[model samples]
Target: MIVMSVVGVTALAVGGGALLMTDNNASAAKETPAQQAAARAGMTVKCPDVATSLSNVPQQARPAVNNELAKMDSQVADAYQRLAEPGAKADQESVRTRVLDPLTSERRQTLDRIATEIEKVQPRPSGLDSLAACTVKQDQAAAADAQAAAPNTPAAGNTAPAAGAQGTGGQGTGAQGTGGQQQSGPQRADFVDIRKVKPNVKNPRVQGKGSKGTFSSRCGRNENKHFNSDNVIVAPGVSNGAHHMHDYVGNKKTDAFASNQVLESAGTTCTNGDRSTHYWPVLRLQDGTKEFDAGAPGGGTEGNVGRILRPTSVQLSFKGNPVSKVVEMPKFLRIITGDAKAFTNGTANANASWSCTGFENRQLKDKYPLCPKGSNVVRTFKFQSCWDGKNIDSANHRTHVAFARADGSCQQGFKAIPQLVQRITYKLAPGARNFAVDSFPEQLHKPVTDHGDFINVMSQKLMKQAVSCINSGRKCG
Candidate 1:
């Protein structure tokens, strides 16, 4: 076997044998039982070779672009190597900072560079294009590799798992592309296939003339990484903060231990007489500023990290039951939508709705549309108001509260409560560019972790008034 240095890494014989990777401080450490027992499966992490594809690029751009890709690939390999090492951080915090965040950033930077370089090519490639064509190639290869893992694929907690290894320790869950089945864990299942996610809402039960109303909240940019308050709702105030921070809208004070009593007494950012407790992750500006998001370095959430998409409109409305009667929502009812556990492993369960002030027709994904002068970036959220006569909260963070099926009828055993819809808009001064949503560092700004939480804390009078708005079909401000 012969050796040569290519871009600081060595090349070895063309056979499947021990590959020697040398570094100034390299040492050969023997394997330990703990390390061997970590992962249920294994995978190879390396940058895809773009040399063969470079032949299609102009000679002038080939060398420069190839170098750029090589750098990206090297970064990926290094990340994988570190993640695979024995005793790597298997916990959620460690995985995000050590694996997800760095990898997400690296992937983002690489794709951005590839996009820049691809623009320089005389004959641009078409189809399978976003940032760089290589992304798709790499993902496809990864998917194949994941599918080929043996023995149930071991939940990716070990095996240097990037196969959606955002902490699928016991479930045998692999990452999305790795063909892993993520069940609302660190990585959520995919966004239910964009095709199935049709924008055309069905059954159109948006009834009642005055039930329509609007309200706004400036949840602020995600200033701190404490938004959702991990495991707080079920257990009053344990951590008392989320892996990220949130902008409080309706409630004047919302914290980890906030109770239904406190929320009712709290003031709201909205001027409308309605006083429901509404909150969501804050929106952020893209200025290269780093914070400790769940997926970001110094992040703290177990199931954290992902793109924080700019919301187009935070539309608000009310819903009623089959009887068309306005019923006050039970006090202390807590409802949460969207998965916070959505990390970059393609387990994002996102139904993010984004749009422009005037360009309402243009709903976008992955990329936030740049608003023209004077227009605002909008974000909207609708909550499920109908509740099962039994539980206020569920183990999955959902299901206890149910959404009205297309017919405007609550399923059997569920009672309809006055549900409020919120839509917010952000006017980014004038000529705003490079604006990004606040997200877990590992989200890589992919716009998937968008979610909302609400607690029914309205006073009896306020609750009735709000419910009347929907039942009477009157729009309240």
Candidate 2:
């Protein structure tokens, strides 16, 4: 009867202990994964004076402690694996709270104290392997603890993109940021460079008055008779009742008010093309003394300032084929000489006058060369500046340092200029003043006398200087 009573009391005690344990775990199980993880991270394992307490612990307690420790090991391993697995962070956090949180506050503290006592009882090991192992465990524990404490904290919530993100767009945020840079690209028009052909005033073919002449030669027309060439052809409108071809210049005839550079002909596209002339620009050297060398010509405009400014040549058109022709300067293509004062001071050019059919009074429309029976005509001219000392004052005559051809016609007769056209005004030599008349011998050119003997003496002196230079130096010009 006494034995039964003892057994009943022991059973009641065991039931109460189990109920207490269940009560302790109920709160932990109910907690969310994130809450549990946060609680475990915040819990501290206070290392106590475990060595003193362990002396009084019963030998039977060792089994319970070892069992608890083994369970902790498995739980830690499982938690680590889950945390490492793809997309299992939330689940792993939950497991840590269920298993690790309870131990962190009590069991872990007791275990840490016990470990300290054990270490005190035994000296350090001879082999460093244990130390290394312990170090690794400590590092892992620290990392795990940190993760649990701040599970939901953002790594870079407020910072800008990292430096490495420049090239990579999305996966690496820093790289993506870098890849969004805007780049400047060149424009299409910038890549295409066009060089316009300058007009020439030294030629004769593009000048003179028009004439009432019939088609005398088959040079400009073909059997099929089509205006396929580059010449500007003009003729009276054909009597095609259905096709009303408006004349190019319309009713505007060749008037003095029109530009001298090109004839003011009909504006309409002429079906029976007749009058056509093509011209090119002429280039002159910078210095007034250089002679024309065809091998190299100048880069800018070219012209002469004699009795009349004339067109030297024209691109002829037969039927549609271009024919090379020569013509004198027309009355319209005259060049006006600038004043000597302006030349000395390097002033802008004067507003010169020009007439397509001679000055305002003597209109030369009747003298205009008539087009072929079925053709019309077009006219164009070019302005040019010249500096030959023949007629110009020595002070006004610029040194011819280079020469060039616009139509490629004078290329054979002139040397090429080294400078660009825009750079011309800046490169002129300063102080080109005229010399006294007493310095020249008689019988120089009549044109130079008209201007003054200033150029003659200067030219002579320059020629002598060049000769002396050539004698002294083998490479001198």
Q: Which prediction has the highest TM-score against the true structure?
A: 1
My TM-score estimates for the predictions, one after another, are 0.51, 0.13
Each prediction's whole-model lDDT (CA): 0.44, 0.20
Candidate 2 lDDT, tens digit per residue, 262-354? 343432112222222221111111122222221111100011101111222122211100112212212222222221112111123221111
lDDT of 2: 0.20
The CA lDDT at 409 in model 2 is: 27
RMSD of 1: 20.8
Error of 1 at 287 (Å): 0.7
Taking the tens digit of each residue's C-alpha lDDT, what string does model 1 give over 256-288? 566666766776655554456666766655333
Clashes of each: 41, 84
Candidate 1 local accuracy as lDDT? 0.44
